[model samples]
Target: MTTPAKPTKNFRFVTGNDPDFFKDKKIVSANRSFVMFQQAKKPCDGIDPLKPQPQRVEKASKRCDASRPQPRTASIPAGAVTETPCPPGMSSDDALGLFRGDRRARKRLVDRPQPNQRVLNQILSLKAEDLPFATPNATDMCSFYALLQTEAAQGVLASRGKLTDGQLLFEAAYEGFMSTFPLRVVGSPHDTFEVLPKFKGDFKSSMEELKCHCSATFSCPNLGRTWIPKATSSKLSFLSTLCISAAHLDAMRGERSIWAPLMGQMIPLLRIMTADRTLNTSDQAIISVLQVLLGTMIACQEVSSNIHWQGLAQLVTLRGGLLQLDPVIAMMISIHSVESSILSESPIVPEYLEFLRQRRERSQPGQPIRYSPLYSNQVELMELRHDPYCSHNTYELLCDIYSLTNLISIMRSPIAELKNFQSLDDMEAERQSICARIACLPSAFSGDSKDLSRRARIVRYRFESCRIAALIYSNAILNGCSFSYAASQITPAFASSVKKDPAPRQNGRNTRSDSLPSIYRNRPVTITSYLKQLLARSDTSGLWGPLSGVLLFVALIGGTAARENLPVPTSATDLGTDSYNVKDRSWMAAVAVRCGVQLGFEYQGTMEKTLVALADVTRMSERCDSAVVEGWRASQEPEILEKSLHDGNGSLGNTSAPQTRFTEATTNEIHIERVSEGWPSTTGQADPSSIDWGFLNGI
Candidate 1:
């Protein structure tokens, strides 16, 4: 049927080649298709192409799913920043204030403050009866050492798992020990002497363990997860290093490993804080505490390095100036500056003076704070006494000492860079002013004997010794020997030569031996007698007083004076014509040396070396004196005289006889011998037991 319908020519498909297709076709075309459709059409398709079909529409569903709620995001305004608000119970402003030293917000977080909850918790963990003995006390010499060891062990174990917990525990233990320990009992013979060395060992060992735990926790790979940040770790290391070095300061003598590492860490952090010039009370408190601790070390000569001094001083200025420093630290720094100036013969006083002036200027206008009100009973118990003459306390006395010593220091400088004293006349006026101030101080021995405690006695001794040293050194400077050179040259070996002539007496002042310009030079016997008295009293006082540092300097001065050719005192207050021999003076110097050794400055080897050299020189002088007498007798011999007269020869018969210049020749020989022989080892060679340090050990 389909084939039958296709027989029609109009219905059949035809190609362009069909004769009828071209004959019937017109050139006209249907209306143009859409340009979009035409342009998108395939090349295979002719000019016309099919249009795109519309997408199919789907009906909306009425069912709802109620399990999940859509998120409600408020539209952010253009150019507006979005931030999360602070949670309830915390003020955003207060939280922000913390960086500026606002403590109110943080104080609220601490539930308890009075009893130091952390310290209380630690104390509760230990046996209650052992609490009194945890620190060194009158009753227990080596108290709390066993407890400290236990704490250290537990800390090490906990540090491996929870580092912050271990650190807190160790800090608690150290604080406990520091709070309880009475440092006065350390060198007191009334307590036990044998216990000190043991206690020191235990203390050092505990500090070492703490340091190890800190290092381990910090170096661990997962430190990021731990509670202690890098900054906290560094703080702990600094504290640990400080404690260890302080405990062993007598022997450490500025060991770089003991101090440098911790200082290195602290300096950078301090620099950052100082550079920003931000007011942070916490940082100020930290620096103040550090100053006290480090100043203590300096006072004890435990640290001789000035590496951090200038930097620390600048930091202190930025914090709140010198007045902001803790009272104990201030006192110690003053003492340290004086001692350093004297020893080095340089004036650190000018810079220190500027610091003080700035502090005074910054202080509020009120009655000047003579002593810091924030006193620590545990730390400054020994310095707590009041001196009525100064109207305040020992602090004023320290200020007085600093003032006088500062002037002396300036005077001693070759250039004398002081504005008040530019010439020798100006120096003399300033010197008189200082001498008057010293004279105004009541005699150290004037106090009633019955009222003196062990600490009082030490204070008295220290004051007297410092006063003596000032007088001696000042006079030496006036005599044309620079104070800087005098300190070193005043050693017993050189004193005799340095003072070939008698020191000039102060103008119109002879009320007492102490008032004399050159007390050591003019009245050796008087000074030695008083020093001997001090030594004898210390021997019986049941306290080991070696005159540490400043005190030792005083003793050395006395010893040096004892070697000079000066007459002994005929009466208690009067100098006499009768003089002690060289051998006797040497013995006197030996006494001073022995006293110095008792105080533990023996490691310095200064006093010991000076005494030994002085003794050798004394013996040489005695030998020369004997040879002189023999030569005089030989000259009187008739046969030798006649032979010399007849021969007209200037040469003597004997070549071995000493001449009048024997003393000078022997002095040169003595120095040469010392160099060649390498000088006898002073510190290590001597056996502590054999040297009769029994006085130090005795009760």
Candidate 2:
């Protein structure tokens, strides 16, 4: 028998039944089977199993007979094997298909007539070699930007009702801008305000140049004014829109790295762009930009600290600030600045007043009332917008309260320097003016002829609370103690001085009694009255929201009253205090805490600190009261008197002229429930002897 097999040089196949048949028979059988298997694997006329595979087979090389390694075959071509130029006038869909990896689609795209024939040809002709420095010229880039703007706007509008995959559109637009206007802003992946580096060309000139590159013919006539180069406005408007949209997505999904930096970069640019001389500051375009900036700042909690808030201050100071700014935004900036100033203890009272003045100057006779972003964004909250007639009055009321707070800050500084006497006369005059102004404003709490809104009620409560707080400040200032000075005076030496009378000086004047402010001097009734009003307003519901904003101010007033050695108000008319007769100002301090809790804000990270601080102040106030009472008692007790008589009680005998003892109290635990329900019970006896006067200023 013969095996019809090709033989390798390493071995040979032998026919059957020859000499050496045993060894050769085994080898010959194996060789014949292997040869048949190899033939089976190869393409055949019709019988090969693997022959129909599309992958080209490699020819095995003769190296060392069956043991040589095989090399990998290419799956697809890495580069164009042949040039296939797209015909001019191809449709964009077919042209875009090339990017989608449909090689046949490139040919199909050439079947249509393209309007941008030249641009289409240039794009199709691009090779790996031409990409390094390749760029579209000015006109082409501008056209391209227009195309991108349309696409981005369509995407934005499509997703307006809900945020869904919305970030992709903005992200693409932002990426395009960054690539096209490379020098406009420079920063790492994360920066709050990215702008051109200082080493670059003049920032203004560079920005103008960048804006000019994208300048097109489109205009938003509705935005008012044609001064802003159409392209410049469009580019900025698109960026701002993209940024805010992305921020909305981020706000919902919390993709922190995505939107935070986008806003951080965009807000500063918007500020700089609005400040650009090329754009009319009062143009509707710039106004829209500012509104978005302010709105984003208001909406995003993370943005609160990163933005250049002072830029808003500068804008408000400009002639265009008020003219261009919406009254709602201006009011927000004013309120926010004042709140921040009070917190930092570095007052920006002048800026706030300036914003208020601008808002008034721009106020029109019959314009619709404006609402804050929170109200505007929520349908439920929209009802909080006050009537047009009452809107101006509402803000005016707020302005008066802010002015009083400014005065209080000014008084504190002078009092701190002990030069308060120089300003006292001026402050007192201003105080009376402010009071008369506050009184002239329609009551926030009462009698509505045309309208009464929840916001109006909130405003009324705010006005009343601020009015009472201002009174407390003035009361402290009049009695030879500014709030700061009074806060600093909670010491052992000061506590000891509480019981002493003014000795007759050689000048024939009483040292202690003469310098006291008349409002707080020789009368516990006035201090008690102010404390009662402050506590009443503190517990009032309408003011519950802004209470947190003005917490420190309220705490200061409460602190002053609590440490004044005056009894808590016994008036049954005070909101929740009808059941308890208070003896110290601790209840007043507790009022701030309870109001914060009732508003469901006590658990906030920010308010938690305020609560701790309030508690500390309350505890300190109680300790101080105990010290004053104990010191007074030691002076009044008969046993001590007999001992002092025997010991010739030096100054203690001279000061025991009068003492009014209410029930004693000690450091009582503050109760939010009792505080919310009513004033805390005054059942426990207090000992003033344990008071630590040294740390009062520390609190």
Candidate 3:
């Protein structure tokens, strides 16, 4: 502008060279001189080539200058832009465009599936108290068929959703039934699902609906009807048909879609069926139903939660009691046993024992017992009296008793006698055989009959009983206690010789006195005396030594008694009167002395010892009576007189003390002195009124 300033290399004005340059600057110099002058006057003018301006000061001044000018901003025209939401049924892209055109309409539409109007409408239209029962109509059948198809489709879709959404469907179905058919819903779908089989596809929805119906039926108790009976009958009819239809359909599809719903319906239907007696008429069907029910109940979570033995027991006892349902009951008991065994610290051992005891008691004699109750009770009674089963039961019972100390003692008591002695003869023989086997043993086996370590105590008592019986019977025979002839016939030679030996007097020791033969006297004396002494030192210690001594003594005594050639005493008084009565008659004396010694020992020992000793003594006395009777009969003695003495002696042994002596003077006054002194007391005193022995033994 200053003389149209000559074009300058550093300062040239060119149009459209830089668009921002025109906007930034108001004018440009054409000449370099003028440009220099203008630049010099400006604050950005360079004073020297190396010098530079402070950017902070320049920026601050520019900002201050800009602040001085009025603030400006671009304005949007009203017609230039707008926002509008698409129509209600429009796509999202259309709505987005509408939103861009008209902003106010953006809030109108939200993307969400329409409420399941069909299912809701179906539920809303359903009338209370009018459940959808099967009808012989095309329209109703078609609607049900269509509903089934729709449910199957919905279930497929729902299966693809989150598990939480699937659960929501179940809950929604339950709620719908609760709201529409309040009379048909029972407890809760959650509870039902715990017991029901997991259904798939549309069947899952159907199950939910079924559960809802059952719950509704049971909910209204005031409807003049029991829901259990009605529901059971209806379900029985419905499920039977449904199962058949499903089976047919599954056959065609080669799939088991109905299996889930069928299983799901089984438990509740079973409860219904069991509730009505009429529904149980078909034996095979009932059994099948029960089987299915049992399987379901066993598999159910609710069963685990609600399990109780008493309920199971009640079920077993129903209808015909345990006898009629023993198989089922046994299965249940077995299950309980296993469970109790697993969970309990000390399982129900006593209960098992009680069961065995009751079974044994109820069993009759001589019947073929069946393990299975399906057989006649008569068969069981037959078997109970004989053979393998009775013995088997006895063994099992014994094992159970052995497990408990208290039970062992109870079973061991004499009160536990066999119901019939004849019937138990084989068992007794077996027991005796076992005892004999043990006796023959050189050492105690690991499985000894005795339960405690102090076995000698038991053996000692048993040996004492045997000795006492032998002594009493031999004395009665030798003393001629009205049965001398009988005694002579029955007494063995060795026992007779021993009984006739003279007494070893208390006077100056007679080394070679005119006593009985040494063989007869010393051997019996040595053995019996050793046993008595060993038994006298009665302590649990040195058990084997004492037991061995007793066993040896018993063997010698039994061997001598069995020889069958021993002499016999003439009368009871002969036993007391002879100078050798204390020695020749010492066998009886030894018996009495041992009895007294045992009593005294027991009095000094424990209560258990005393009781055991008493029992041993009682058993000995009984055996004595039996032996005396045998000896009397074999000798052809006066039956009446012999019976009296034998019976009297037995009674006396039981009631009187061993230390109580019968004086000779009193014995003679009572006409028993001779017998008491080793002569037959009734040798010369014949009573005509006495019965003859010839007729007694069928002679």
Candidate 4:
């Protein structure tokens, strides 16, 4: 070592500076004992250690360890690819197939398919019972959040390991929430924001967006005639602020965290305050709590009425219904409550329904009948005498839905870019008007005795079920989102509002209204329970009448929507009182299957086609084939006829193919043909990755 070779620059210890690309790729030797990282210099058959020297250079045999027996050597091929290594594991064809993403690779690596195929093939359920509720995963110490912190806040986060300027993050997140999913009320502009009160003077407040330079501010109606009151934004407390921030984190990054100690402390304080009957909850505090609840729902991406909604309902009940609250607060509760009810299959809130009824009575004084150009045909549905099979208010709601659907369809076309409609305000007003109609109409029959034929009663019952199904259609297909938003803060507070006395407290909790069902005594009624009661009588054989198709649609929707981690009892004795009590996916699918068979549909493809059409949430402009023009022709009744109805250029029905594919459980050879109406029968799905969902936003 002392005689250490005076370092020659060329005589480095490592043979090459650049490591081989395939150096890490492990390959087994012939005996599978030794592993080698060697490239094939030339392709050949096998090795023969004792062979006589040949005239030509010998070929490189398959890699082998000392433990393997040798075979006859073969002549090296001049330009053969690294031949299938004779290690006897993994063929050349198989290696090539893996490199080039193919079905073969997918089959071999069942758990890990090729990247693109792998991602899309996963069956992600929208609503699963077993999927854990969204909880905060991030912490104050996370460097990711440090990016959002101020210098002072960053120092606090570093040294103290606490987030003090969380409001800054919350404000930023509120802006994002407003931009991403601004839940608009009726009479409001599309994709608008909740305006904050930027005070110009003492005791003077206007609907001016504060210093926030958010995109939602640009879209928001800044000055005169705002629908959402400024009070909503102004009253949000730090608790609500953190919640909104958490929701933003949940939506954008799929990661969430909150000030856990603060929350824990606040919960105890809230409990103590709640226990104190003298300490009445103010409107602002209630509003903040509502925001907190709403934020949690958003964070969870909730599509059903779970615990949050139940608590919210109870709080609203304590507050003497939506009317007694500030107008804007009422609107917030109404929108969330109504939409959640529709989604969860719960009964419409009585307060909202009564409010709509009063509005109807008030507007009846001078308002003239008006119909959208696309759905003048549904005007008759408004009259109880027009169709005994239809409920007057529900059918009226359905009629408006059709109009709204057509208007939205037209608005989504290129023609909308030209600004053909009166204005987005008018459209939203129309939608709000529809929301009010949904509120006014009962989701199911009153179960009151009526003078009608046996079949007529059955038909009317089916029609009621169809209305709720249509609500689902509107919530999912039309909105392209689970949440529905309606009711205007500007809607004048009703004079004779329901005023309930504060519930008498006993043993630390307030006594609930005794009139309500026992379900609400514990928790609010779920839509599943309501549906079961609604369908109790319809267990007999009877056509859903003219609305039979709609019933099928509803059944399909219920089945799909109810796909959750439900426990199925294998033994009959274990079938508890709850067994078959809930009309779950199994029940719903059975209903659909039976209906399909009764309707003479022999192919499972028919059901598949129906499900696809139900989920076709694309904009009409993007979906239409060779959409040269927004195809609407003049008609006397409705004033506009969809050219797709008459197959102009290419049928609009062709445009309604689903963006995603669902592999059918059963595929039948049977064909039952009768041209689809505004439904796909001739088109295939779009590329799953290319789906654009911007149409969901009204703007």
Please report the TM-score between candidate 2 and the true structure: 0.28
Better candidate by lDDT, 1 or 2: 2
Candidates 3 and 4 compared: the better one by TM-score is 4
Task: Provide the lDDT at 470 for model 3.
Answer: 36
Note each model's CA RMSD in angstroms. 31.1, 25.6, 33.9, 28.1
Per-residue accuracy of model 2 over 521-574 as CA lDDT, tens digit each: 122223333344333433343333333434444543543443333222233112
Q: What's the TM-score of each model vs. the native?
A: 0.28, 0.28, 0.19, 0.27
The candidate 3 region of ten consecutive residues with least summed lDDT is 690-699
**Per-residue C-alpha lDDT of model 3 across residues 221-317, encoded as one tens digit per residue:** 2211421333233324324323423332332232445544565555454454445555443332333343333222222213321343333444444
Instruction: Encode model 4's per-residue lDDT on 317-401: one tens digit a residue.
Output: 7778777766545644654444334333344565653443332112234423222112334643344335455555445555665
Give the lowest summed-lDDT range of ten residues in model 4: 483-492
Candidate 4 ranges beyond 4 A from true positions = 1-219, 222-238, 252-280, 300-310, 360-699
The number of residue pairs in model 1 that clash at the backbone is 1
Worst 10 residues of 1 by lDDT: 56-65
Clashes of each: 1, 11, 58, 2
Q: Between prediction 3 and prediction 4, which has the larger lDDT?
A: 4
Ranking by lDDT: 2, 4, 1, 3
